[model samples]
Target chain A: MVNLAVKIKDLELKNPVMTASGTSGFGEELADFYDVDKLGAILLKGTTLRNRDGNPYPRMAETASGMLNAVGLQNKGIDYFIENIYPRIKDYNTPLIVNVNGSTIEEYIEVTQRVNELDKIPAIELNISCPNVKEGGMLFGTSCASAETVTREVRKAYSKTLIVKLSPNVTDIAEIARAVESEGADSVSLVNTFLGMAIDAEKRIPLLSTITGGLSGPAIKPIALRMVWQVSRAVKIPVIGMGGIMNATDAIEFFLAGATAIQVGTAIFRDPFTPLQIIDGLEDYLNRHQIDDICKLVGALKY
Target chain B: MPSNRIRMKKNVGEFTIVSNSALNNTNYHICLQSDIGLPDIAPGQFTNVDIPNNKDIFLRRPFSFFDVDYEKKTVSLLVKILGRGSKSLTELKVGSKLNLVYPLGRGFTIPDKNDKVLAVGGGSGVAPILQLAKTAGSSPGQMHIAIGARSAEDHISIADYLQFAQFYFTTEDGSLGEKGFVTDHPIFHDLTQYNRIYACGPLPMMKAIAARAKEAEIFCEVSLENLMACGFGVCLCCIEPTVKGNLCVCTDGPVFNIKDLKW
Candidate 1:
């Protein structure tokens, strides 16, 4: 059997196929269609210190091969997550990574501190790159200074593996990646949703409630791969790559491009079983290539 | 809620076009019948129809289960050709094979016996309201339907409602019964007359009806047409913020009580 285990700092993923946050709701939602334990990891939806109502109606707008969402990071806050969601999902076999979003530096530390107390929660992904919310989402992620500050503060409060999620809507993504890594981030996930918008030509109005929204799907795959490649080369820490991963072939491309693990985001919306299918596909790919260890594929790109 | 995902069972149904009438300058109503056994589809539930012309519209366009004939295994649809995805749906031939994902979305709740129900619909939203009227019609004469459109031509023929209950129509251009909005119609002026209210349509229209029903403290439910990729709730795109928190519109409801919705 091909060894599929890959390590990201202290934590080890069964495979490189993990569900991206926001796309997969707490991992329990997809359990009906596919076995949740089959996935390498489940990145739960973005959680905040307080409950957020999110934006108004028409939060999603469909494009040619993709979709734009301005969901505004609506969640039941961190406390309810610990009390209601965690206890249930903790029973699942897959590693659980809580995606934390904060409006302020202190909020980030507070949520990370709470997550550090949970025994079942293996890691915390500090989401500094959400484009939909009005406050502190992509704001902290765009600038290197804010990104490092948030990562460093959370690193101080919590001892678990800290993954700083970076936004694609930046001048130099490598600068931000380096900033997070220098601030003691365990690893980094790159290429959060790209900012996009759609219009109803007839109505002469924007489709989403929020005029501009975060775009995700096959449309952004190439750009995501480029960012993942650049950031992987720039940082010493492991990189988790995600964008428009639809199948195993796409997952292999990310691994070849230097991602330690890959997250399936938009594809899950189309087929809930995609991540599991990807895991199985990766196994077949490794067996065919005669690669004994999957970790060898990390940053294997030749000059 | 337990994951409702199950192995998709394919069922083919044959349907004939009874009438293809132009509802407005742009929209058309293409009604059809099927020989195969049809599943139980509730109001607010929709069918994903595959269109032949455009390959880009890979996913089926979701249409509300406008009307159903169980004995004949037939279904009717009010198709408004708003885009290329919908325009392709209107061009189907009389004996065409239409692949459909039937009975998707949570339907409206049926009112208890002896309860007076007021059903409101606007634009293409009239489909489910009519279906609810048919479902509620078995009670003799307890169902009331109020439909609104921009003009008289925008209103689809509702001959099926003759046997159900009272029917009210409103058009903005004053071509039909009342020359105003559905809320402005004389029938809806007295919200206390109905024991329960059900509405679906444009967000603003549903919100207006919901507000009126709430002020009267009447039990009211609304079906939201949130943008959805997978009608099975996997997308997390069709989420509606409700009193119960964020719930999937495809699974938790296309149908939700007005009280539950934060709007």
Candidate 2:
């Protein structure tokens, strides 16, 4: 059988297909439709040191190919996640990665410290690029200095794999990628949602309650691919690519572009079975190509 | 709960067109029979309608589970044809096979058997409120329903609701029961008469009702119509900010107690 196992630093995934953070809630909600063990990993919802009440009404807007969201990191704090959500997810076969968010460096440390205490969680995905929240979200991810600071502080408390999820809203994504790597980030995931807005011309009102939101879906796929390629080339750490990944072909494209693994986000809304389909498709591809291992495809780009 | 990823079995139900009539020159009332067994559906719950005519709007349109005939397994809807998406839904045949995602959002709270309930619906919002009245019809307590439309022609099926509720009608053009809005009618002048107030329809109308109910110390709940993509919670497109935080309207609610709402 073709080996689909992939290793990123200290962590190993059965396959390169993982669910993106925020899109997949703590790994419990998706269990109704599919087996959780079939996934390579599940990135939990974005969490902070303290519980946050996200933005006001109208947090989502629909676009042509995808949708926009201003969910504002509405999640139970890290403590609640450990006490309540973790106990449920820990029993699953897939690796659980907590996506951490904070408005300040100290908050990141506090969250990471709490998460480090958890026995089942294997990694902490520092969501330095969430566009919906007002404070620590896109703000920290936009600047290299802030990214470095948060990554460094979390690295101190957290001994597990630290993945810095970068944003595409910046001028140079490579610079931020390098900054997080320098600060001891174990891996990086590129292309969180892009800042976008839609308006109703006739009514003279914004379509979403927040007026503007983070755009995610097939519309942002090309941009996400380009960013992943750029960031993957810029850093030595493993790159987890995401944004608008809908099918098996898209997942394969991310692998060719140098991502060790790919995350399915917006596609889950359109078709719930997309992740399983991609996994099966990837297996077929490996067997067809006579490739004995799936890891051989990771960063297998030819210049 | 872990997110369910498998495609649930598509339940094919048939809805006979009880009465397909026009409303406000733009909207239509296309009621159908839900022959297949519909599980427990709540007030804020919605159904995903299969638009057979078009490929452009491949995704099903989510409408509140307006009303249910549990014994008959039938549900009804008030469709407002605003664009190509809704226009295609109105074209669906009465006996045609319709795919629906039923009981989606959390339904309104069931009133206590001894308490009085008031349901206010305006525009297309009257559908769910009518459904709520039918759901709470068996209660020993009294139920009142107030419906507001722009004109006489804007009104739809009232015969069904009349049997279950103290129905009140309002039309802005003085063509119906009363010559004013539902808020203008004497029935709503004193909100304290009702133990709980439920409203849906236009945003401004619901807001106004909520404000009045809050002042009269009555518990109020409104079903919000935020733009939604997936009726399930995955898209994160139907979130409403509240004191408790940003919650998915599709999951946490299309129904929210006024106290939790920021507005």
- Give the clash count for each candidate: 3, 22
> For residues B40-134, could you state the per-residue lDDT of candidate 1 as single tens digits?
77878886665666756634467888878888767888888788888877776777666555557789987767889888899999888888877
i-RMSD per candidate, Å:
4.4, 4.0
DockQ of each: 0.25, 0.28
Against the native chain B, each candidate's TM-score is: 0.88, 0.86
Which residue runs does candidate 2 get wrong by more than 4 Å? A1-3, A32-34, A143-146, A200-212, A284-292, A300-303, B1-24, B29-37, B48-61, B69-76, B91-102, B139-141, B190-193, B228-247
Error of 2 at A272 (Å): 3.9
What lDDT does candidate 2 reach at residue A95?
90
Model 2's chain B TM-score?
A: 0.86
CAPRI grade, predicted model 1: acceptable
- The TM-score of predicted model 1 comes to 0.82
Candidate 1 lDDT at A279 equals: 87
What lDDT score goes with residue B21 in model 1? 67
Candidate 2 residue-wise lDDT, A8-78, digit = tens: 77888998889888777776666755677899999988899898877765776667777788878878798
Worst 10 residues of 2 chain B by lDDT: B1-10
